[model samples]
Target chain A: MTGQVRTVDGRVAGRRGQATRQKLLECLSEMLSSSPYRDVKVIDVARMAGTSPATFYQYFPDVEGAVLELAEEMAKEGATLTDLVAGRTWTGKPAWAAAEDLVDGFLSFWRKNDAILRVVDLGAAEGDKRFYKIRMKILNAVTNSLTDSIKELQSKGRVDKTVSPAAIAGSLVAMLAAVAAHQKGFQSWGVKQAELKPNLALLVHLGVTGKKPTK
Target chain B: MTGQVRTVDGRVAGRRGQATRQKLLECLSEMLSSSPYRDVKVIDVARMAGTSPATFYQYFPDVEGAVLELAEEMAKEGATLTDLVAGRTWTGKPAWAAAEDLVDGFLSFWRKNDAILRVVDLGAAEGDKRFYKIRMKILNAVTNSLTDSIKELQSKGRVDKTVSPAAIAGSLVAMLAAVAAHQKGFQSWGVKQAELKPNLALLVHLGVTGKKPTK
Candidate 1:
């Protein structure tokens, strides 16, 4: 748990204050979805939340601070992505199913928090440590789980020893994240969403299991 | 060829005009690397370029327009990426080498134009059709070639028939691009650049051939 919510001035927020803060975040989230991150002014977010700019400032220092808070919340939710890979069997039809589920879950999670994730991705890519840490938190959930899967397979001689489990897992997770973020762009290339999932799943299975899936 | 360079007013740029425009773009590109894209203003770019804001406007309608121009230029250069995949064999030891070369080439390209590419990626993800088209133009060069390679393999019955070549190629290329853009981030995950390349190449080979590389 994140412990007691505190204001920028270091005061613990009461129930009413937390409610107001949550409303501001929801309004800011909506604004991010509708407009560019750079153009989302604090005053506009405050107005959208039916509150004064002064009240907004009490909860957060600025728009980036609020966005970071949103990212933190999403990162907490993203931790559950580990379920898509943890303890999953990488053999036979189940391997294929595991890959399919991962691709599906990842794409849906990305589609859900796309706006905030976009900012997190940009911030991380730009070398901001806070954003970078949050990005890693979300990705490591799945990447770490997948890495263990590959390592276990390698130990059993089911996968190649020459393959670096960490690298493959990291790359595969990155692929899923990238593909999810650009799901719409795939449509423009004449690849429908329905067609993309299975292919992505196929690649995931191929990378992890080092063999064609049994379907 | 892309035809005669023209200003926003539709006048053909002479040699001198072209040089000034190029300088402004170079300056803007530098600003993007050093500052957040949202905070980058035309006045700052103009000041850095040793010109007035009026001169910046003559060549570009605004900062985003100038970024699009830079992205367009990068996309043109990116066409050469087709060489990394085009006509590359997917059999034996040569297949492993091809994968390495493609990964190397893609990563180097992303590093060279990271700043502009970052903006382009964000724009495309935000549903800006112009940025999406430019992103497609760059990725398509490699994606199209890789797709053809997969299709050829599939036709020979070497690759699985159920696999969608475009989707696989797109996913693989997306993996490469995503990993490339976040090469620095990988280090934090304990994946060094030297160690990262071979593993990425391994995944690329597996995805394309559906078998581990003979190497």
Candidate 2:
């Protein structure tokens, strides 16, 4: 009830209004690259968007609210693990193979959108309460998919009977988070996508198989 | 040259003056529990500390600088992964044991000073350049130790050989992060320590050993 809603009269606003809003958010995200969330002002944001200060308030309760909105938007997407490994017949594939595909999918998302991904990292860094749920929800989805695949593999008795798929599922996500964290930190350091692929394949294989990769 | 450090003395002038400065920074971290970072102000900080706004500027240039100073102070100690897992030798302690100890250390720091941790998260959440580097440095230390252990195990053939230790290492930190994120998000939701431990342990064993518990 307290947050701002972009919709009006039960209809999503038009491009002109949306364009103003979009430009404002974009500038805000860029500003955030160097500035902290607490220090930004509505006038500063409006000026950055080249719009009237009143326009800034029209779309957002305030600049912080606008940034929160952008962060939420960023949270809504990324490459899912299942999308990496299987299409229609996931159960048919080896768990390690499926995991590799998932890692690649995740890395690809990081490669393309390091800035937005950094937002998730920062939100969860230590005691950041703001974006914790949104970030966790994303993690849960990844782990849940891994669980499904592992359960399928366990049913086939293809996986190590001593291991639980759910554990592997959660672990796999944690490992990927490290990779994403590394990518965000080193993006300005000229990280080549090729360099990270081997690491991803290696980790994914190890994560699912409970053994180090021979390849 | 452009920052608050004027290059003259680069220090507080007197003892009472220094105490006031420390109190202001310290209070912000705790006060942030009910207040969002953006909602806090110099007046609130000064009032809470029983000081004047004029006196606050004598130390910090502004509120953001004050928070950053605290984050820098915490990170100045600079812990490594080896420091965490060392001095307690085990051939291979179950994932839960190591995880519990590690989480205990992290949460101990967090619970004692939620404000600074909260600020660190906010700074990082905003993904400002400085915040990401600070986060990566701390996590990298944690991951490096786990990675080294995994590699040692690989050489001894005690663990899987095909998997990259780096992957396992990455997963370890990421999962811990997830639990920490959980703890942080539910601070007001009344989530307790008991609910968090199993999750942290589950992540460690699953991610590292890739095995379900024998216990």
Candidate 3:
């Protein structure tokens, strides 16, 4: 578990400091949604939080540092994604259900934190290791679980041995993440949201089972 | 075909003016790769182009305007992606080859223009219609062709009738784009670039033909 929240000066944040820090994060989060990451400034976040810029600096070195702090918080919540795949059977009706649940769960999570995830994705794509590590922290929770499910099937000869579980799982997760990020793109492409989800579930089922789903 | 290039003021750019304009775009494109999109400025691009900011203004309204011009050029190149699927037969070995070639072609194109494409992606994801349209112009060139191929297979009963060709094709193209955008992420996950391509081809072949490739 994460230790107590601390200020930039290394002092553990007291209740008042923690409250101010949380307010600043909330304001920063809003700025990320409304404006591009590069345009988000500490002064703006501080003004929105009704605090001084010096106080903002006391909690975070810079905007990127605060964004990383926000991302770490989200990564902790991402741990819940394990339930979407762990212990889920990939056979018959249950397999169909599993795919649907996974797609639904994954999409909802991405939608909820899309603003931060976008910055994380951009930073990671730009080769920033800090952002990349945070992205992996969030995605690996679900990806590792799916990889295990695929490997379990491979062991029983239910899936092909030539198929790399890690690759397939990673690809499928990438597909899900991409689709979730561009849900509006799909809608504009003439595929409705309802129609889009089922097809995504179909692809997930196909990727995991290597066969058309029974449903 | 596009008519003669024009400045933001609606004047047709002559040879000398066009050269300055193109230089500004080239400089802006380089800036996009080297710096974050939000931080890219018209003044810097103009300075790098060895011209005044007024010259940059004559050619483009803002950084985003110049970026849209660049994206337009890339979308024209993306039209070539249609050849990866348009006339290719998708039965048996030919299907596998088609999938491999599509993956190869798409990944190379993405890698070549990733920096601009990243901004375009961010713009589109932020609901900017101009950027979204350009993105569609690029991806639709492939997605529409893949959709037709799926529909063709469905007509012959090679693909299931219940499947939505648009959805399946969109998902596959999204997968390719996502994978291309994050090739390094795969490498870091122990799935090398070499390993990643074949698995992507397999999924593409499976999604299109609904069966394992002959290879």
Task: Return the TM-score for each candidate structure.
Answer: 0.96, 0.74, 0.95
Model 3 lDDT tens row, A100-195? 999999999999999998888888887789989988987897889889989999999999898898999999998998898888889878888888
Q: Best candidate per DockQ, number?
A: 1
Tens digits of lDDT, candidate 1, A1-215:
66899998999999999999999999999999999786899999999999999999999998999999999999998889989988899999999999999999999999999999989989888888999999999999899889999999999999878788999999999999999989999998899999999999998998999888888
TM-score of 3: 0.95
Query: What proportion of true contacts does candidate 3 retain?
Result: 0.63
In candidate 3, stretches whose alpha carbon ends up further than 4 angstroms from where it belongs are: none
Stretches of model 1 off by over 4 angstroms after superposition: none
* Sort order, TM-score high to low: 1, 3, 2
Q: Please give the CA lDDT of all the candidate structures.
A: 0.93, 0.61, 0.90
Per-candidate DockQ values are 0.80, 0.28, 0.68
Q: What is the lDDT of residue B195 in candidate 1?
A: 91
lDDT by residue for model 2 (B160-197), tens: 66556665566456556544544544433343466555
Residue B199 in candidate 1 has what lDDT?
93
lDDT at residue A82 of model 2 (Cα atoms): 41
Report the error of model 1 at residue B107, Å.
0.5
Evaluated with lDDT, which candidate comes out highest? 1
